[model samples]
Target: MTPTSSDTTASPDVSGVVPPTVTAFDGNGDVDPDATAAHAQFVVDGGANAVFPLGTNGEFALLTAGERRRVVEAVTDAVDVPVIAGVGAPSTRETVANAEHAASVGVDGVVVVTPYYYPLDEEGAVAHYRSVAAAVDVPVYVYHIPSKTGNELSLETLGRIAALDGVAGLKDSSKDVPWLAQAIDANPDMDFLVGSDSLLFAGLELGCTGLVSAVANVFPELVVDLYDAYAAGDEDEAQRLQSTVFDVRSAMKRGPYMAGVKTALSLRETDFDVGGLRAPLRTMDDAQRAALETDLRELGVL
Candidate 1:
């Protein structure tokens, strides 16, 4: 299918606790479209400013191309907020295909990560993102997570990529404070969404537009409150909330990251049956769950 034009003029103003939503599954281990839609709605109702479907926490790597498109369709249909689909694949062609599919489905933007498995040089990374951005008109947020992609996008290379026509902003999961600081300083026009919940307050203090936090999948209201408080200039409240959020994040990080998210969601008042993680990613053991529950209770999230 030909890529649709995303001439939506204004760049999407996406910010604040956009959950890298988990792709809900049924017992059969297939993508449960209805449950996935319900989960998206669940988070939005819980106070997410936007929905980011098929991201790292959503297990984008495990999903097939068709599943990826379908997940975006379901999420966009379910939420009124901007849906930024993660179209990062190991190859440029696949990433472009995913971006085209996201555009065709009417998602507001696409988050394209560095092509993984095979490390790409600065020029290769720039070219990869440029081709994907040119293939569609929708806003593109460069996803920088060298820890997972094995290709660290340098500040210079990132600047070049940000200058692309359709590029809108960046989501930095790199956790490299110095690099993030440099990127923020160099690209004043870009909207930087921090991917770590632990950095929510710090990121906001650094002038980050918002957070794309995994913890939001479980505690959307708290995450939203922290962002709102900080944005509202309520430093004391934001600081308190950030500390509590840090504790919750520490507990979740005790297990497999995404599985911990799904497990935590299962305990919430959600309409979706967010089954389990995809293959090779198992749920937390009984002891881990018990410890997590205790921590959540202490944090008043249970």
Candidate 2:
């Protein structure tokens, strides 16, 4: 399904288990748009409410500008769900350009991570988001993953960003419950997506409307069930699923950073082959793959 042109004034509903999908690659380390789109479709078919491409899982930092744009285009064309492309770069100019490209391709919205490498002051962070939000007509969701970007956004900066014209919400992976709760309380109207699998239930309880789960890329049904149970007011079921997710998360972390999802996908019954992570980011070795498979089997996820 082709994505329709984005509506600038209305914020797209990004609430639910949205997978920050991995970018599929061919053997030569080239981006494979078809395989990437198929992975996106796979998650959506597994009951994911939406899909996010070019995120951390997508290895956004490694891809060239052209590769990033192609992934966005392919994923948007493959699924009828909201596609929120990750358009983050270290520089505001590059980020704005990425966002503009994403919007031009008909994404529902864009997720902008905090500028990395150089530490940014609160004012700089706010101004960066302001410029990105102003450049595109689509709603902009702030991506706050400090561990990766090396730039942390404070509550004051977030409040200012939330007030921007086309700013829609935030996806917080900081894992700071107090900070997340305070942010939610402060911005009653802005949507919040819990970006860590460990805090999905907690995030929902703290008033977050959505989840941007890396676990969802491999086990979309598990995350979706958790969300549905909570929405259905079945706290017990949600908690049980959350426990299950913890197990799954542990098993997926058996390999190198960001390797588990793709490895698990290859091990699934469907035997999906999205290829290995691009160089510098290694794939699971033989031993790691064996261990991961055994763990998944014990958990009955494989």
Candidate 3:
């Protein structure tokens, strides 16, 4: 009996985990394990309730399959935090394999994105996630960011996956706020994280549980502060901080998501250059770096 998109009793017991944006590095375009650990600790110390390794912001699409596995393991080993592995690929087999690996490595959960670079329609996306979730034992977070992947996890698709046993959450990165509201109300059981930091304050104000933001990698404390404040009815402080956070969020628009985040970290510290975009993405230019700095300095973040 194929399950309809109405069931939600079997979802995992994950209540308040802020799947943090991850960092990448290497001496020769490889997974630098130590830096990985350091970055994991950075988020943990900054107060991320959990970590989401190999996310799009982690440049998962750019890394090799083996490197992805290493990252999932590195982050899980680095912190006492629960790691939700982002195990999405262009094919079901690969996604399932990654999910199985995440479960094998003992990650707390797996966040699965829709398979990009393919004409995956609603039915396909639904099937892809269901198969991936069934292959692993941990909870699964359905990643919905259409801008980069060329695929959007529609409310119908999201509901279907949420109905499944292992699909426990949805990472809504779209700019559409109404559907996000719909998704939250639609799946009262599954955790729906605000995948966009710019909307984090407003999203939480409306009832979002947490955020899976890329910018969180740069200013985790600020992000966590908002989460804590909003949850505790500190609307006065949340609005004030949200306005100031724009400087950092604005600079991120200057380049690719991961590159922009890495650049921000580089500007703030002496020991954090993870090197260029994996490949195809040429290294950021001097002018671009200057622009990023300008934004950071304005925010007083640098």
Judged by lDDT, which candidate is best? 2
Lowest summed lDDT window (length 10), candidate 2: 1-10
RMSD of each: 3.5, 3.1, 3.4
Q: What is the TM-score of each predicted model, taking all chains together?
A: 0.95, 0.96, 0.90
Q: How close is candidate 1 to the true structure, as a TM-score?
A: 0.95
Number of clashing pairs per prediction, in order: 0, 0, 0
lDDT tens readout by residue for model 3, 1-302 = 11224443344333333645554667577777668767878877888877788876678888888988888888888888777888888899999998898899888778888888887887898888879877876777888888888888778877777777777777778879998898888877767778776888878865677777677787778878777887788998887777767767878678654567777777768365555567765555788889989877878766
What's model 3's TM-score? Answer: 0.90
Question: Candidate 1 on 37-147: residue-level lDDT in tens?
Answer: 988898899899998998898889998888888899999999999899999999899899889989998999899988899989999999998899899988888998999
Ranking by lDDT: 2, 1, 3
Q: Which residue segments of model 1 deviate by more than 4 Å? A: 1-8
Off by over 4 Å in 3: 1-20, 255-257, 270-272
- In terms of TM-score, the best-performing candidate is 2
Q: How accurate is candidate 2 locally (lDDT)?
A: 0.91
